[model samples]
Target: MPRTLRASDTVISGNPSPACTEPVDGEQAEQPVLGGAPSSASLDTLIQHLVPTADYYPENAYIFTFLLSSRLFIEPRELLARVCQLCIEQQQLDEPGLDKVRVRKFGPKLLQLLAEWTETFPRDLQEESTIWLLKDVVGSLARCEEAYCLRLHQVLQALHQKLAALGPGPESLLGADRPISYRTQPQASIHRELLCICSDPYRLAQQLTHMELVWLRHIGPEEFVQAFVNKDPLASTKPCFDEKTKNLEAYMRWFNRLCFLVATEVCMLSKKKRRAQVIEFFIEVARECFNIGNFNSLMAIVSSMNMRPVSRLKKTWAKVKTAKLFILEHQMDPTGNFCNYRTALRGAAHRSLTAHSTEKIVIPFFSLLIKDIYFLHEGCANRLPNGHVNFEKFLELVKQVGEFITWKQVECPFEQDPSITHYLCTAPVFSEDGLYLASYESESPENHTEKQRWKSLRSSILGKT
Candidate 1:
């Protein structure tokens, strides 16, 4: 750890000039130690660059630690111990229960290097601080008899002994409790916010579209498929599953769930008039989504209404006008792999080229974009049999991805509307997806006869009374 003067280029904390000595021979023998190895200062600088700074979110800290672990040349113990300790300590400051998930995000690679590759750890590996790092990994990996379990078991025992020697075990804290004041009490008054916002479908659509954009902004385009694909396509093009890819999948599920829930609420309403009103409201919402180029929510709204639970509500349908609804449905028809949607999206994109302040493409329907990405994934090989890259195929995918990226660049026209935000965020309790689909499947004669039998029985009883 101490800096010694081997050559002139000894890097210190502050700027220091290299020592200059007069040459003895005809030519200087001290020809600047020609590239033998990087100095300690250079290695430290590399680590500094690779490691995440203090401002990094706790969730990403493990990844920084993961990269640090891959450096086999370094003194892996002291540095790695500090990283683990800081991650656990920082995560505990916010949500203590989330520490396990946070640490596990670094993956099994962290443990593999520490247990198998670390030849000579620092003398302080027996220290309680260092042992706790091993224990955290043990808890995260749930390793009972894996390759690293023997070493980890000994480390855990040492840590426990050190803790016992210090004092009694600390008292456990009580679990978090939800308070009564959090719930809103019911009242017989008009919801002025909803009444005002419901009439302006454009405003409502913009708000919903904005929410989608907010979620989308968190995901980088590269990060979406980066984790799903290989580092070098020519080496091996097998799909690799990872944490970020899981996040992308979950994001799609949320969109689908949100769509279905809204329609379920509309269908499950008790009053036919209010229910009819909500249907018309959602219909206008669909139209607004189409107009604003937010086809994601547009598709969501149309599909939600088409869900049989909403569709079989014949009474509600009878009162509703289906002109706009029919138009939207025809556009989303899946017969040609939803090519109709592809054309509509292209047209909407063309209209958006003018870049007016009044209109913005808040959220482009990335469903088609994702579909294109899937085709790109499966349609062509990344490399040809001759070992050259399939550049044509690769470029085609890149072009599609480029268009997808460019589509999101349209200037947003509207500011946040709190009235619409409140409406979209809050929703009534709804049954599961399976329950709704089951309701739809039971609409045949056997179920209809059962329903009619119960109705006639009720009628007979009322007549007798």
Candidate 2:
């Protein structure tokens, strides 16, 4: 390996620096065309640019962009190892006289590059191999120059603490620590009991906001970074991938549970008036969630109320008022690509930005946000025709995901109601089939279509029993 790189050598960074001319592992690196446009560069070119030269450092934007997109093809540990190898080879530590001079020139910039990587995506260092490689690199630097020892160790320590904090806590692993009460209550008695306890719609909304904020707060950029990665065939047997995306999965499950809970509450009631009352209660809860900028919960409640079983209860709906529910549905309508919902989200976000109180916070429907990001990622090319990274695309991704980072930081203004939260978390909800069966029982099949459907449901339920 030569100490000085030639200008014609391939480079991913916009600033052309000397690079190794030989194709890494017999793979031909993509060469830049005469025009400024980048052609598709080899993965090795991208990795080489990550190693900072004594006089030059990779731009911050480029560093963030590469680290994010690189993970799609290669694991973080391997990438880190390659970077360490390049840094060492560049130094050419075999010669006694030049060692001190090269280390002195290159050491701080190397530390800076590593610091940027660790700070931006600490989760990447979760693997033991990556951590060991990082320590080795830092140790080598510490040995070369005593001045870097303190800062290098500090970065390492902070990373360990961060990884520790990111580990799942007891509360996350197990639902509410205390045992759920009212487990013994019969199905018939439980519906009425639940109504009496959770009668206050405003209070219910408050408790829901509390839970929503808790989940949102813990979700880091790493989750979104890995959102588009293809699932491994063995992900089910291996817990690693699940742990990486658990906060996202848990939030989604919360949405589903709330939807089923709303449906179960309505269908379980024997009397039309009681069922109508439950419907009205949930409508008000949805309204309150909207007022609190809790669109996620609002959509869950609205979706449940609109479920087939719940919607088929013509008699129950006739008795209930739906003026407020209609407005909520309109705002959440998926028409025109959810233009109404997007407008509402923008307003809430603006209010949050300008408001004096945390109550003005906005939490967008997270699943939709993830969908938007996935499309953004897929829509753009990773490399330009001239062989440079598509840095512009990454900037757009950062802007979108950056807003979420801001939104999650808002403190929930509502006071927690322990009993309401407990009930929300622990109350047993009926499955979809159960909800349909209960719906038919609440109101007998209106005609033959209903009669046949009801019959099939009965047979299925009985057979399962």
Candidate 3:
């Protein structure tokens, strides 16, 4: 039998458990069944499982799993308040004769549950209002039982320190500190030595991998939840995870920037020979990304190369070898809903799961992962027709989001190349219109319609200048 953390196991003071430790399929992990209700219990029934009775506390694993994914249906603060209220009500704290008896019975367990929450996902309590509510709840408990006051204060202090440590440091990325528009600096001001410094495709791939890992690390699971939640027209106030969603958007902008950068590199070259070399170079880089299991960059490179501006260069295409590019395209092909890439991603994930070194990493095509999560969220109702929390749906969300959390934790084994990194980040990339103009300049229009487009593009581009 697989050993799971039991209710008696304290979540505080030992080595930290992973964000999730639920048993996989074909395994029987113990689940909390409040009031002997089945897994299909209502949300109110599930919340009761969290309140400790005289003889029972919920399992540590169940608590962690629930708290991690609960945001899909309820806000953390609201949940915390509800749980605390339930505890007070269950203990009958207002009753004069039984107050001491109830406190003696349930006070320690209540403190333990609160500590478990704050310790496991302290970020949920980072908001001032949440912390204030927590302190108030704990204070009321403390007033009822003097022995628990110091322990409660200790939990609050430790949580404060953890939140403080999460703040950006002096060396953190400037772009990550705020939500900024994804605008590239003009080509005239950029370092135009171009790809001369980053000639080795493997080195360029390593640098790109490093950059991708850094961006991935800054995003939190809350960002993924909030990204699709606010789409409901009925959402009133901004969700607490709004800033986190900005981080997710910033990562996406990085992907877009990389795509535009690849296109710009191919189109900006004046000669067909140079354009072909750059195309081949990018293809080689994309291949390296594939071998290294960096699918996001691989897709970005493929996408930019397939854009109309770069794809229309027949002369450039004629000069370059196309065999490997075709294979990369096939792997990323949208046909069959990217079944090929999904298979490749699964292989990489398995490799990472068993490997001793971080070299066996699997950074997925993140936007696709987001889309999958969004669809899953949209497809399922937040509550059952019977008004339960939809525990089954929450379990599936845990599995998907948990996989991403595992991927994000792998440290990039590649060393950074500062000059190449600077070049990649600061390189000027043209907008779509500029790309069309660049393509026309390289190869004159083939027909009357094409001629009209080229003339109009030239007039518009010059007018912008």
Candidate 4:
């Protein structure tokens, strides 16, 4: 401790002063940034260490591995295989969270794998796994736009190839060996879910329209038309009617779903011009149904179709009802009243007279106002032959009966017309604070004086004196 030396000799001899012996700054040393490329040895070490752990890893860990592997571009295929396995497991477990995370992490890669598998595999394997995988990828992509478009394009391309191979037949694309788990209800559910997620009515409408086109082409026009017609001879039977009713009900239900998608979910994608086109198509279909006398079908079509300026619905309904009435009238007899004719005339007289003859004679004179001499027989008595019958009373009775029968015969057709109900049932009435009041313009002094005079006269007439 007491040793001392000269500075140059002490430095040379490795005996330095304490102040010069301070350590270099660690902060000044170079450091690698996070998320940057690691050295090859480090990556190798990571893969070796992760392999065993990844085997026992839970679903979230697998997803994390997949995402990390994608960005790192190391062992992507191995990670993707593990992810696919996890996805299959998640589906079996029915764990929505795990399934969603797997889909979100690896949907694009899975789609790529599915496309490659479909191309590489045999026809049978392609039909079994590839098609199903494609469908699942599409379903998953509903949550991610980029993925959805990529998968959708892939599916469309695959579908085109499948369609080509199968040719123009129902069994071609679907195939006999492959099981199609996609039923109407599930398809509808998927469509609804997609609509909810996208909330883009135009996109939904476009998707549905494309689906409709594809399905229609596959089914063909003849089969589609047959589906709409009343086919069952046993339709009167409860079971048959029930089945048909159920089919129509399903169509109606799905139609309502489409309506909501177009109206609410697709608001962002909608354009006035495009909406007008849709409306125009609906009107064209409605007109076609009307021309074909398919009123019930027309009503169903109209009910399920969407239009803007909702008031137009009232006008459309009015047209449909009017058309139905016209058709009904055409189908029935043209005489003034079918019921009255059937009730008043005997069988022989009914058979003897034509509808036109009945209209001219019996209907005009007995059911309508007799405005001309043509309504009466040229030489017949004006009064009944019996003396007990008073002529004036007979004419009055005939007039009253004629009016009643005519009113009963020709139904007003419209249910809520004021003139049809003599303005009674539909007229509006107003009351004020538990009292009745009459509506009037402001009264003049002379009118007020006249009202007072009438009140005085009424009081005098009822006086005790």
> Each model's number of backbone clashes?
0, 8, 0, 3
Listed in order, each prediction's TM-score against the native is: 0.51, 0.78, 0.79, 0.17
Candidate 4 lDDT tens digits, 288-382: 43332222233333333322322123323333323433333232222433333233333323432443322211211111121111122112222
Model 4 ranges with Cα > 4 A deviation: 1-85, 90-94, 98-103, 125-130, 144-146, 149-153, 162-465
lDDT tens digits by residue: candidate 3, 1-465: 001111122111233122122234433323434234234446676777767866778887567557765666678888988887786677766445456666766778877887888765777887888867766656666666776778878888888876675565212342232222112233343337457888889888888888888787767666777665564668743333355476677778788888888888888777899889999999999999999899999988888887888888888999999889888887876655667888999999988878865456788998788766765665565654445565655566767888887887788888888777776676666778778777888888788987888788767756532
Question: What clash count does candidate 1 reach?
Answer: 0
- Kindly provide the TM-score of model 4 when superposed on the true structure, using C-alpha atoms: 0.17
Best by lDDT: 3
| 1 against 3, candidate with superior TM-score | 3
lDDT of 1 by residue, 137-214 (tens): 555445322444555665445545543442321111111121111001111111222434557777788777766665
Per-residue lDDT of model 2, residues 263-365, tens digit only: 8788877789988888899889989999889988988888888788888898888898888988888888766656788899998988888786655678887
The per-model lDDT (C-alpha) reads 0.49, 0.70, 0.71, 0.30
User: Which regions in candidate 1 have their CA more than 4 angstroms from the true location?
Assistant: 1-199, 230-241, 358-362, 426-429, 433-465
Residue 37's lDDT within candidate 4 is 17
Model 2: lDDT of residue 385: 53
- TM accuracy, model 2: 0.78
